[model samples]
Target: MTAHERLHTRAWVLHPDIKSDEDRRAAKPALDEAVALAAALPDLEVIGANIVPLPRAQPGLLFGSGKIAELKQTFSENKIELVLVDGPVTPVQQRNLEREWKVKLLDRTGLILEIFSDRAATREGVLQVEMAALSYQRTRLVRAWTHLERQRGGLGFVGGPGETQIEADRRAIDTQLVRLRRQLDKVIKTRGLHRAARAKVPYPIVALVGYTNAGKSTLFNRLTGAEVMAKDMLFATLDPTMRRVQLPDGPEVILSDTVGFVSDLPTELVAAFRATLEEVLGADLIVHVRDISHPETAAQAAEVDSILSSLGVEQDRPQIEVWNKLDRLPEEERTALLARAERGAGVFAISALTGEGLELLLQEIAVQLRGARHEAQLHLKFEDGRKRAWLFDQDVVREETQTEDGFDLTVLWTARQAAQFAAL
Candidate 1:
């Protein structure tokens, strides 16, 4: 190879299956997901992946010394330059393992941070990821640097122990955090203004959310006819994208494609991405796209639900479960899943890639966005011109007769709109 030629880092992925953990996911699928995550980074070449069963975690090295020796042999044979652990690793464990295996190490959180750093496109996304990474780094600074012995000049109030390396690093991170937060706040304010402007428009928002690589972007492209980045990769779409499209036999609506969720999404990320996820909160309807062919679909759905609930998406919020990737399944399984979906309300079976059953899904979305409507005759007094105007503005008034004391109107409106009118 030429000296200037780029080379991918040889990496191995390991998911530690802890027996004592009550919430541990199945080992094989978890390891598969981890391997996919490692491959998502352009520079990493995933050479091998395994699920390392652990009866109990060792404090110092995570894996037992015997198991560590075995892994080291395998890694050395494969020329692995990096090890990706699919779970939390303490700073001590990470340092010890790297020293023993003579390889760079990254825990699940660190790997995710790397992916987010690589995928973030917008200014706000970049700032949020940097802040979250700094927060994560602040927790693992002990012995990470060699400057702990040196001390800078302090404010001369005599101190027994002067600033250490970790303390100085943390202070530096705090300063950076303050700056990033300021920038993020400004960006968030601007986004809020944009959201408020969108609200003034007549289009309702429909948000697509699901586990990573569940075909959301494909569905989004099919619905909006915009060529977004749709690939069979984790987090192919990190920054949210929005487009306006008219639903068939329905009103024009804004379709929002959001970042896909994953099991055990880093807490720092959740906090950092709040500005992005606020779009979901404002959505009139949510479409959860699922890869129905996957073995862990149920578990994935639960994780998505947990994250949504944590985000304060109310149970009563209108939502549809879209069983996507129907074309990938065998005929027998496809029929079974479709039958099951038919037994539920607000559920759809479709192949977003092939555009199968999309018309039905679109029709359902239109119905959900419209909500329940009823025709009623409303009598408003002359003093209630504000209410009368609101009815007209909503385009719900069918016929009106102006009387000396009042206006008599026939209106078709949803229950929520009626309540708003009553409030007026």
Candidate 2:
């Protein structure tokens, strides 16, 4: 088989609970998204999907023996090679399911990890993914090494190779974890130095965050004229990219495109990606770009909000919600979206693919960046030429006058900049 065909296989989704009408209703969209994601791959096919309800007190397997038997037969008939469970399954549970169905079984976390591993491009991103995968695999090693039983020596102490294998695996994983942490720490320190330098220049940072394939990069390119790699695939842009964007007032701010968030993101990934996500924490403004055309856009928005809150960034910062891809919507739907924007909800209806409503959004961002401070006039002695030069370098000077004793200057700057001047 070719590389694509080797990775491609038939997938079946099994959601463990569909007990009520509401449960089934709520699960349909998630199942649909999973199927859509699966379909995006070149070789994967979704032959069958079903929701199984479990009664109280049954714990060994999610479904009863009868259901398992039927599922096995169905898997055989459909030639399904893999089962994707929507919920997390224990290593033991996964092993049992694979044995019972005679096929590979993966839980939601594993599937997401696989996608991330495939999509990661940068060395840091790949290292982070590898760390997360190792952390996940350490727990699942039981399934892979089950044949090696724990044997005892002559004196009933721990035996030789068997015990050594377990210890060696644990020690190797610990060593790798420490090395990854050290590397990540270095990256974090470098980022901190960069942030400090940017602070000295003091350009407002505007970060774009949203669900996967929500046109964040498209809008980012439209606003900043940057040619970042934007595509329709999930997790297409894993590395954060930043560009200097000039506002309507000619004041420049840095706009950053961050990795997109998804539902039920892997815990290890969240921890691993925290260094990259520090950009959001340092942002002056956040542009939340949503694919308003998606059926579950609201739920996806909630997921983004939840992740932001977890990052301790949901509050205080000014957020502009851009309802992107309006051109794909029906006329009435677009009108309603505009009505929502008119309600002073910090929302804008825009088509990033085309150049609609972008100017107004840029103007609003400029207004926010401008409203952050006041202008000041200063008089300095000739010996204070250094301070004048410093002011010119650090803050926006609106007006300047030179005299024998001193130089007079008018500057527009933040209060923090003014304080820095006073210290000078």
Who wins the lDDT comparison?
Answer: 1
Compose the digit string of candidate 1's lDDT tens values, residues 20-54.
89889999999989998987898898989998999
lDDT for position 199 in model 2: 52
Provide C-alpha RMSD values for all models, in order: 5.6, 6.5
TM per candidate comes to 0.85, 0.79
- Residue ranges of candidate 1 with Cα displaced over 4 Å: 1-6, 142-163, 371-424
Q: For each candidate in the order shown, give its overall lDDT on alpha carbons.
A: 0.87, 0.78
Q: Give the poorly placed runs of model 2, Cα more than 4 Å off.
A: 1-7, 18-25, 37-48, 56-58, 142-164, 371-424
Worst 10 residues of 1 by lDDT: 143-152
lDDT of 2 by residue, 113-206 (tens): 7777776776678888889998998877745455444443466555544567766897899899899878877867776777757654547878
Error of 1 at 159 (Å): 9.7
